[model samples]
Target: MNSSQLKPLLSIGNKLIGFILFVICAFAIYNKVLQNENLNQYGADLKIQLSKIHWGAWVLMGCLMVLNYTIEAIKWKSVIAETNQFNIFQALRAVLVGQAFSFFTPARSGDYVGRTLFLAPGTKLKGITQMAWASYAQLLMTICFGSLALFWNLPFLPWLKWVAPWGAAFAVGLFFYNQNFKGWLSKLNILQIGTGLKWKLIALAFSRYLVYLLQYNWAAAMLSIPVTGLDLSIAIMALLFFLSMIPAISLTDLVIRGQLFLLLMAPFYHNDILLIALTTLIWMVNFLIPSILGAILLLGFRLKR
Candidate 1:
């Protein structure tokens, strides 16, 4: 077949792959929710909680979700600025596309693949490397906060104390690791942006992390799960840490996140169904929603590969 004939085949193959992955993820999530007998018990209470939620609160949560991704797009755009100038809309689309691919891959590796595809054809490798630097900043925030939470909950299991220091050390390493990459970074002009951008990157990451926690707390309240103050903060740390450190397919993250909610929140709260509902809702609002929107956006996406 001529190259022209191959282009259509390649495009069809790519779309099919994306669609199949989404279906698999949806099936995994659906099966998990269905199998959870605990979740079934909350059917009526879940409805009640939804009814009690102020329309304003729902609107506020939606706004927060928008803010979350907006910040992320800004971060990605800044990282790629040295390579190419991307408008806010392009950055937003790239971020969503990353989320869409992340649904199927382990450790969300597909995120880089999806994002890099939007770069100038030959610059994809540099684009991915820069974008990954941005991700490292976010991961560092997760590790630091998660370690602190682990320290707070460590007394519960004294034998596991070693993990906290290690996590903290890893966070610290992530912060300085950029120094070792200075030569390569200079080649890509990442270092040309100066230390000011370094600080901005860290600040953006932490701010995004806090937004995630705030959204989760809101979701918890909406589900009638009474979580507050330091306890809630610790749970936030634990969830982010656990999710950050683990290597799992995006679909399985829901199951893992749900179990963590049960384990971490069990002492403070007793409603199993509420815990499941809260986790699932947060997942749907934060992750699944982006992926769905990304899928829609992907219909018009041209795959350079």
Candidate 2:
């Protein structure tokens, strides 16, 4: 089909998919708020607890969020180095713009588009594809380790067990499909399909994730929630991270994550609602802060000519 024909079809399909996701997210939010009887009292207590938050901890968390963005910018630059040279500031701006797009778009595919717009004219498409593939590799590695952690934790929830295998299979399939594992690369006539520095890209991505985990841990501490075991926290947080990868969930992403954390850590903390409330607060800081900053960055700066 022609480009014109394909564009409308793609647009319609995306809208349909986005509508479905919106409904699901809305339903999940309604269920969590109304049906989860335990949360009502917890919500009241959470409000009281939040009213007593220490400003010092809030400041520290803010600094960490800035650090997270900085590390992410570095990671993107590392991936881009394989294809072309771009200034760190420019790359960082691109990252922010991409993030802003992700925040608004259902599937967050706008992130790729925003990033691509930042590339030099001749190699834009290739650069975008390469960065995407490299990012995918890192996520795949995370899912692999995370899956193992899940199994080890032996989460009683059947939904938890189902995620690991499905995630692993999807990651594996993506790797082979993108790489054309069966020698399909030759058909494309491209010199390299990814950023040449695969290991560095992976390292940068892995380090970013580590920072994210640390950020969450610190956030939990800030809320004075007791962390009984690192192993379980890691597994649960990893699962939360995996879920965040699913696009178009809206704020359901944060709510579901908070709920899951509560479910998994229930054994450790007698006060499940308080912990979940704390988790929700931490998630807000992690997501909303960046989103607000990214929006500012998007509005204030003009792309360099």
Candidate 3:
């Protein structure tokens, strides 16, 4: 077939993929909210708590969510600056739509597909490698903080306690030596993200991670999760640590979220409806809401791949 005929077919196919993503996102969200019988029982009380959340905390969570993705957008823009630069609006749009793609895909791997396509046609492929560097920084931050949270706050086996400090040391050392890894990436003729830009990416990722914890803290305080201070931080770090390690489509991860939260918080809080409510709240605020917005954004947007 002629190139012109193929272009039309490709456009139709892209539109179909977008439509399918929206359907999956909608179904996933519906399942996340309605499928939980415990959540249904407490739905009214949760709504009441949401209504009663101090106005200041409410504003903070809203601002944090905005800041969360804004940091994400800027991190993306910074990572790709040397190769393909786009404005903040484009970056933000791409990040949100990437969330939509991540919702149903295993390990959120669809995120690469969703975000990279927004790059100009020539740079899209390389954008994958470049952007992955930025994603790794966030993973690194989770590990670094999780280790510290473990070492400083939580108690462990007499034999295993040393593992926490050692883990933290290793993660910190890895942070400083990240340049060597970057060197390998460049040696392979992968994009040279450069030294300064690498630090910028780490700083942005660290800030985003803190904002993430702050949002959870606010929600926990509002819900009375029965833990506070260092203990609260430990639970959060543990939850984030395991969640990051799990390999699953986020669209079907409501169970994982609940189990992880209960397992991590077992010491500080009893298994109860409120814990369920906290997990549900964070999931909605962090994942489902953004993915829903992303799905809406995808409706008229062109899929590059």
Candidate 4:
């Protein structure tokens, strides 16, 4: 197909994918709320649980989330040090705005659009390509560490076992096949992907996962979930967050995370409803809250001219 013809076709495909994702998310929410019936039973009391949350703990979690974003911005700055003058504030804004887009859009292409806003107009595309590479590097590191933790904990759920290996392989393949990786490395004359600044990038990426652990731990604490022994919940939640990146699923993350919590923690908690509610609450706080704020910020402020 000609370039113009192909553009329209691609747009249609993207829209179709988005529609499917919405339907999936809607279905999951419906089933979780309606078919389960139990969710509704405690739906009233859920507000009480929320009301009981310690403001101090909530503030601490919010700070950690900002730290996570800052670390990501630093990582991106490291990757494109030569190509552009990386500003931490700009990077953080882009990251949060990108995250806002990720919440509702299928596959999170919104991240790219948000990141592009920060780039100098002339080199927006190049900056975007580099950002994609940096993201891929982070994903690879998360999967590698998360896999080790997954196997170490070896949760009671049989299906959970398959997630680690498959995720690891896919992440590795994605890194190797990434066009941006090749382009960035070539432009910078970097021979080894794991050398110098790249190592720092990976470290920053690891920090993001650690930050997530803190966030999840705090969420568990808020829900009065016991934190004894090695906490595998963080690793499992990280895995779910990673899975949410895959395109074509509507609200798959919201459902999968809630369901997985029940499967993995129910044996210990003996309260599936509480676990699911906690998971859902945490997801809403982490994803939905930021998205709403980002939308407001984007609308209220003007971009750099």
* TM-score of candidate 2 versus the correct structure, residues matched by position: 0.71
The candidate 1 region of ten consecutive residues with least summed lDDT is 184-193
Alpha-carbon TM-score of each model against the true structure: 0.81, 0.71, 0.81, 0.71
Report how far off residue 191 is in candidate 2 (Å).
Answer: 7.8
What is candidate 2's lDDT per residue for 168-268, written digit by digit as tens? 88876656544433365575646344434665666776776777677767766766777654854565655654574665433556566666676666556
Across 88-193, the per-residue lDDT of candidate 1 in tens digits comes to 8899988987887776678889789778768987778778777877888898888888777877764356655567768678666655654434554656554333
> Which pairs of residues collide in model 1?
none
Q: Quick one: how many clashes does candidate 2 have?
A: 0
What lDDT, from 0 to 1, does candidate 3 have?
0.75
Output the worst ten-in-a-row residue range by lDDT, candidate 2. Answer: 296-305
Pairs with backbone N, CA or C atoms under 3 Å apart (clashes), candidate 4: 21-250
Candidate 4, residues 236-291, lDDT tens digits: the string is 65455446445532245656666666655544566665566676676666666655
lDDT of 1 at 131: 82
Candidate 1: which stretches are off by over 4 Å? 1-52, 178-194
Error of 4 at 103 (Å): 1.8
